[model samples]
Target chain A: MVENRPVLNVITHLVLILGIVIVALPIWITFVASTHDAVRMTQAPIPMLPGGHFWENFTQTLLGSGLSGTETAPVWRMLLNSLAMALMIALGKIAISLISAFAIVYFKFPFRMMFFWLIFVTLMLPVEVRILPTFEVVADLGMLNSYWGLSIPLIASATATFMFRQVFLTIPDEMLESARIDGAGPLRFFWDILIPLSRTNIAALFVILFIYGWNQYLWPLLITTDTDMTTIVMSIKQMLEAAEQSPQWNIIMMTALLAMLPPVFVVVAMQKLFVQGLTETDK
Target chain B: MLKRVHFPRSVLPYLLVAPQILITLVFFIWPASQAVYQSFLIEDAFGLSTEFVWFENFELLVDDELYLQSFGRTIFFSAAVALLSMSAALVLAGFADRVVRGATTYRTLMIWPYAVAPVLAGALWVFMFNPTLGIFPFLLDMVGIDWNHYLNGTHAMMLVIFAAAWKQIAYNFLFYLAAMQSIPRSLIEAAAIDGAGPVRRFIDHIFPLISPTTFFLLVINAVYAFFDTFGIIHAVTQGGPANSTTILVYKVFNDGFVGLDLGGSAAQSVILMVLVIAMTVVQFRYIERKVEY
Candidate 1:
């Protein structure tokens, strides 16, 4: 913008427009396909515009048994399961990480650094790398096919702990000194001062972690065997498989839309926090 | 790293850390150790018995062509995804950085895709490229190009790569745009005064300045493609078309959970853990350097 060259500005706009289109085409196609009837969706060169069957498709996908042949849970049940899993993971990680970070930052205790390093090591052991043994552990604990199974094993987050630790370190030492002078115990200090201070950080992290928890695939896929326990994210795979025979593109795409809507809405609605959370946590 | 003025030392800290420590022990450390232990012991198919055969699984994997190819494929996939997504993001970010008006609008339009799950990304792309009914194939057919990921190995890889890259563009765009915007405006203005065009200034000045962000994103995207794209591959191809798209993570899951090759899968897990550790070390090193800068 130093020197506005007319041609360059035009080109920039064109390029950005093109980039947005290409980036958004898949979602657009999914939306258009969802709006159509099953008969029209199966035909070659499916309708590129909205169809009249949008309500029918949404109601059918949400309430009707998925794909007719597959023994899947109702869409509402799966969405509830996904919501439950996401909330548990986000809240659990924030709670434990805040306390652990508080302890590490505010206390001088034995094996404190050792404890920090233990949490740090979890960064290297993503679930994909240790699929078998983690599965065995979950199975042995009889956690399979439960909400706890879906959420808790994934709740211990090194990144969240580290981010909170960083946040705690930035708070001036005088706050704690004054709180101590006012006869506040450690828990009171944490609840009153630290929690309020890090509220935005917690909200930001919640935005990121909620999407993360909602989008979990491999863990939930492995642990959840019951139909009612299926997450909407995981059920898309089942619907895709079922589509080989049924080709219920309208219902399938509607389900896909529902599967992605919550996280996408969270991101768009709280984009500032989402971006802040992403950069901070990843760093 | 402790504060100068802190609470008195007591058993309270232990209680504070106990929940995280317990979860880490039960889920993270114990399973990781089991993976290492089981890697050395070959288990019978029926869970009857296991014989301690140290390094045999590793040795077999080293000699196994399929495992080796999967390792290579994983590297290639990671590189391609990083390149494709990064370049696209770079271009879009560069332009977005230029336009002052509607910058946030452009950003909002661009970044929401980051929220889409990998599995949903796969589902969306797979639907678009569905050979019989999809719009992409229909369009590609007009160009006289066949597109069937079901039977075509190359097409399957392309499909997953596209889906993975598509989902990742939003993340890379945000980072790249942030990095680019943080560059001092005076520098670009000075370059323009010196008769450097936008493209030349971009290549000569802006690009070099953001190299740290580039390096940081490269590692992040590499790690992401390695681990996070499991859902995409699972939903889209299932590592199929004769296992052409089977990366290391997929192969581990396939061999362990589906095929039930316990020792081999454990060995694979151990190797993957090593890879992750190495990547994490590199990323941390870069982050440390970024801090210094």
Candidate 2:
């Protein structure tokens, strides 16, 4: 049997190897391209290998934007802002999803179904399509050009609420009944019982929210006009427009690949957890 | 089971729901209404100065040949991208599901493309398709076909479809693989024991079980393709090569931002909302019935 299977296994491995090459090549090329100077990248059959100008390019990119270079992109500052903004988004989503899910599932009340349906209905409204009018709300609330403007609206996603609720619905009633018999009050039982059991679900939500927040483009790009408080995506977008002609493809590619790292790492490191978390959705 | 509920718990539900309500209203409901309101007005050909003319924008949008053509093109593009991406993902994910060696690595590599920013992905393909240095042009030259996206409408449209497909294939793959992994292995084995060949077992057993997930993803992906792809289009071609790539969302953005005609953009947006809402209603009325859970 082992001898007979060698050819099939070889084909499988070959296909997988090809898959990895295709998946990693664009990004791998981008990473190397970032290290080289811009002038070198324009050459034909561009270098297939990494160059030695990484530090030089990195330093120049950081300083390249600012008043000195036609409205310089504060890449580092935006990195910090992006981290802060994405963190807020992640934290806000988790807290809200957990709380809302608990309320709708564990504690029943009037209009419960109404509210649940309402939250779920929110999923259908594509934010990109509705963004123009929402700008007016941002203006009306005086939330424009601030972290509040960037973070507030995103926290309202019905998707996470829907996700957490689905996770909650799967647990057997026996656990809750047993906890109640043990004299564990609501908060104590939820903290000790529910939260511990749902760690995987929470982690999945974290990965999902973090990536969504990190990759946000149009809204942040449109809303935040201030250079000091722009998200990484906004900064990247500005860099794209500013450097459209003869773009330092290396630096831009580097930033793009770097931006993608955290999410990719989240998926890789938590592969087992994320898979379980995703698979658990139907429950 | 009907014991008296505590007061704190009674108010707790509202507290939990408050943030969602506030954010949704401000970001979604309010702005959506505003978009509808602005759709009724008119702006001059110059576009900067706005004047209030009731239903003129909407009326004009109804009679506009350019809008009609672009709208039809948008529908065709959305349907094509969604179906192609979904089918591709299902096949790849199904293949990955059975492959034991390096399965995790393969999954990770495949899904990483989803994380690439839209602009970056768009730009990456531009490099690939550019005639002076693009790999595709190199490909076309060997085949004795002149393929230039920068100047050719057909080539540019193909490039847009491929780029858009690349962005979504990763996401759909993740969902399908996740769905397949959830199916109990015992059933698959049992089906195999009954003499279901690989292809037969897949069609009869696996596809049905995965249909719910497939259906759910269909609705979600359909919405994404219909409304969220303007960025990819905007970044790649700006609806170039004789406006063949211009879709509805791109037109909305172009009119609102570039042309400085807010009224016209809003009118187009209103029509956009109607189409989306109608599609959503149909999805729920007919397609959603197939969702198992």
Candidate 3:
């Protein structure tokens, strides 16, 4: 607002428009490809505009045995698997992190710092680094091909716990004293006071974690050997691999769209919480 | 730091922290230790024999030409991705900050790609550039350029870099835009009053002021380019076209899972762990310094 030259303003708009186009071009193409039939998609210089087969591809990808002859599970089944895993990861991370953060901040217990550093160390050990051994551990524990395999190993989040700790630290001491004066026990106080107070933090973290859990590729790829256990996100690779034989770009792109829709919807619908969670957790 | 008015010492704290600690131990700690242990031991392909060969695996990795090439390639890839995405984000953020209206709308349009998984990002880009049937290849045909990432190493690397950088733009843009908006308006206005143009004002005042954010983002983007782009490479190239796009993380996964080189892969994992730990420490230190700012 300080100095708005007309030329500069026009350039600014142009540049931003260009940026948006570059960013959205792939999704647009994916959409366009999804709406076309397999015959149209295999043609060169595929249609820039969407085709009329949107519902056909959507139903086939969602309900039918996706990419017939491929060993991958149906799209709806994979979506359900993804939903179950995502919910378990997001909720499980929030639940464990809230209690652990509660214990670390609100109770003077033995080995508290030890436990804190232990959790902190997990930040360095991303699942990508220890992929094989972690797979072995999950397999050894008989957790493979199950929702627990998909979620539990990934749910021990250092960022969420740290975020909750930061939120609890900013809370005034008077709240705890008042709760104590009201004769509320620790569990009661946590359930009534801390939980309610950190509500927005939890929601914000949930927004971020839901996307994270849903988008996970490597972990689920390793453990989910059973086709029924395949998540939609991981199933894209299967479809892509299967495309070597079928070249079913319509169903493949549709599966890709379905895999990404929920997480993308969460981000767009909960943009505020998404931004808050992202910035706060990284900090 | 504990609260000033914490509850009395009791077993409740243990009860509360048990779940996190147990998961951390069983999954994180145990598996990580196993990786470290397996790194030092040589295991045959058939799992019929495991011989303790301390330092041999690390020695082999140090001497291995392919490992060295992968390491150098990873550095190149991360640096390229970080530079491309960060500069793009900085430009868009710089312009977006100038927007007096509909900034949120601009932001919304810019940031939804952050939700797209890396693999899906790869899929989308791969489709757009599918050599035989892609839009880009078709367009390039008129200009006498044959684009086949499947056959060309350089094309494959470029395709992966583009996809990875594309996915990262939303993240860097968000952070850069936040950093820019947080700068005091008066500084820019004062510079404007001093006869500096917008570009000049940004170069002199705004850019230097956001250096800390820039530094923080460099580390963030480096870590991201290192780890988060695995799915992208896996889905797009699978580190193919003669290993042109095989970053370190991909190499680890391929060697371990696909090739079944247990010892070598475990050693690679250990090296990656060290890299992540080093990066995490640097990041935390930057955060501490950022707090002082």
C-alpha root-mean-square deviation, each candidate: 0.9, 3.8, 1.0
- When summed lDDT is taken over every stretch of 10 residues in candidate 3 chain A, the lowest stretch is A65-74
Candidate 2 ranges beyond 4 A from true positions: A1-6, A62-70, A108-110, A171-193, A242-244, A276-283, B1-9, B43-56, B142-147, B179-214, B278-293
- Scored against the true structure, residue B30 in model 2 reaches a CA lDDT of 73
Candidate 1 C-alpha error for residue A58, in Å: 0.7
> What ranges in model 1 sit over 4 Å off?
B291-293
Model 3 whole-model lDDT (C-alpha atoms): 0.94
> What order do candidates take by lDDT, descending?
1, 3, 2
Q: Residue by residue across A29-109, what tens digits does model 1's lDDT show?
A: 899988998999889998889899989999998988868899999999999999999999999999999999999999998
C-alpha RMSD of candidate 2: 3.8
CA-lDDT, candidates in order = 0.94, 0.72, 0.94
Docking class of 3: high
Give the 10-residue window scoring lowest on summed lDDT in candidate 1 chain A.
A59-68
- What is the C-alpha DockQ of each candidate? 0.91, 0.38, 0.91
Clashing residue pairs for model 1: none
- State the C-alpha RMSD over the true interface residues for candidate 3, after superposing those residues: 0.7
lDDT of 3 by residue, B241-286 (tens): 8899899999999999999999999999999999999999999998
Q: Is the docking of candidate 1 incorrect, acceptable, medium or high quality?
A: high
The TM-score, computed over Cα atoms with residue i paired to residue i, of candidate 2 is 0.86
